[model samples]
Target: MSGPGTAAALWSALGSLPLAHLVPTGLGPWGDGMARLMLQPLDLLLLVALVLLAVQNGRSWSDRLALVLPLSWLVGGLGGLLVGRELHLALLCAALVTAVGVLAALEPALRLGKRFLRGGTAALSLLFGLVAGSSLAGHGGALQALLGEAVAIAVVTALLLMALDPPHPRWLALGLRLIGSWIAASGLLMLGWLSRQPL
Candidate 1:
């Protein structure tokens, strides 16, 4: 199955497509709205693909966390969609959570300052919570901000998660590598598509 982190990234990327419509300039030839719709399902597909990769990588406790992280990510994104929170705020929360979990699980391997990591996370979480809460008091810009944040965080998180050498089944590792390769390829494809259409 796909890890939760990867699934979240896929959904966030798919969600980003809709945001393109909100842009005043639109997407040029791709601006009429069809391109956004066309690219939407690719997000879900990517999520599924990631899960498959995770399964192929291996079955372990850490791998399960990898799976759950994506789910947490999905919950956070869905929260923004349902409750109207800024996308960036959601992403900050998600990243914070994922970072904490990763740090905690890999503590044996990581030699960095545990205090700094925990404190920094707590501070960022609190700050983001306040921003999201305050923004909620005003208007509907939450989705826009949150979705934008999602795009950036999800993309970055995907890379980060892929970078780690989480112990797992041999097949699973192979699967993860394959997934990583695909994620890289997908990034290139997206860049090419975005650049060709004009800003």
Candidate 2:
């Protein structure tokens, strides 16, 4: 074929590519736009840390405060959506993960006071919720996505808490601490990478 004809054919082939198939329709059995509500690795890690922190002190308030975390997140997320503001949730979450993970890792060696720990947990919970919520602004069907995300977060957190209820064996506790350290490390890495990106 002549050069121009070959170019035309190539353009047509490219145009015919099933680009729609590569994009998420977000129409799974769950619901339209539900995919954005799915829990991410960072979300799970944060929830795990929250649960561990809640059970760390074995106090009623700690458990109750842990429950508040998801509510706070939902409020923040919805608020962000309403205001149409973009929040740097990933950066905030990464920071929180690192801080919480470090504390968890150190819990074995350095004992934190109950009052101080509870206060910190409460503060962090609210912040996490707000930041995480704000970050959901771009998701489809804002209201539905926010509710679904909140529910999914709550369910996952509850399950983690139930499964890892403490009075954990020494080995298990150590394992959790190690996990915390790993989370912190991951957060640090993410933060570094984000820092280098064009704003």
Candidate 3:
């Protein structure tokens, strides 16, 4: 075909791509953005570390700390929704993940008071939630998007809690500690990447 005809055909094919395929399935633009933000590798890692930390304190699932963790996440999500600021959440979350992971790895050896650690965990949870929620504020239907993301976070956290219940065996406990180390390493790597970005 002539150059003009070939270019026209290519443009037509590109334009013909289905909107559903262009966007996330079931969730329109807002939902798509919310899902993308929540399901990021770093975000998922943070959630996993948070759940593990919540259960790692050698406390029962019914412990107040364990129970309050999810609530703190929700509150943070709400705070993020209200504040709607997209400033530096990735950096904040990375730092929190690093802190939480280090704490988890050291908890078995360190004699850090349980109350202090729990308080730190709760604060991190709120901040992480805020970061996650704030990321979704710029999308359409902000309220609905925030709620959807919060519910997803809650469900994942609940499942993790259930799976880790009944207390971990020695082998599993060791594995969790190792995972904590890995999370801390990942967070550190992320921090390094963030540092190189232009301000």
Q: Largest lDDT belongs to which candidate?
A: 3
CA shift of 4, model 2, Å: 58
lDDT of 3 by residue, 80-182 (tens): 8678665466777787788778876776677556677667767876887677667655444455555555556666677777787737899988888898899
Off by over 4 Å in 2: 1-39, 59-62, 138-140
RMSD per candidate (Å) reads 14.1, 11.1, 10.0
- Score each candidate by Cα lDDT: 0.40, 0.63, 0.67
lDDT of 2 by residue, 1-199 (tens): 9999998886655433332212344443123223443435666677677677666656464457546766776776666666555555677777888888888777756677777766676566566555545554544444555566667667767677777777788888888888888888987887887678722
C-alpha RMSD (angstroms) for model 3 = 10.0
Q: Candidate 3 has what TM-score?
A: 0.74
Model 1 per-residue lDDT at 144: 45
Best by TM-score: 3
* Backbone clashes, each candidate: 17, 2, 0
TM-score of model 1 vs. true structure: 0.31
Candidate number with the higher TM-score (2 or 3): 3
lDDT comparing candidate 1 with the true structure: 0.40
lDDT: worst 10-residue window of model 3? 14-23
Model 3 pairs in collision = none
Q: Could you tell me the lDDT of residue 39 within candidate 1?
A: 37
lDDT of 1 by residue, 12-119 (tens): 565445332233224322232223222333333333333433333333432443434343443444443455444433333333333433333334344435344334
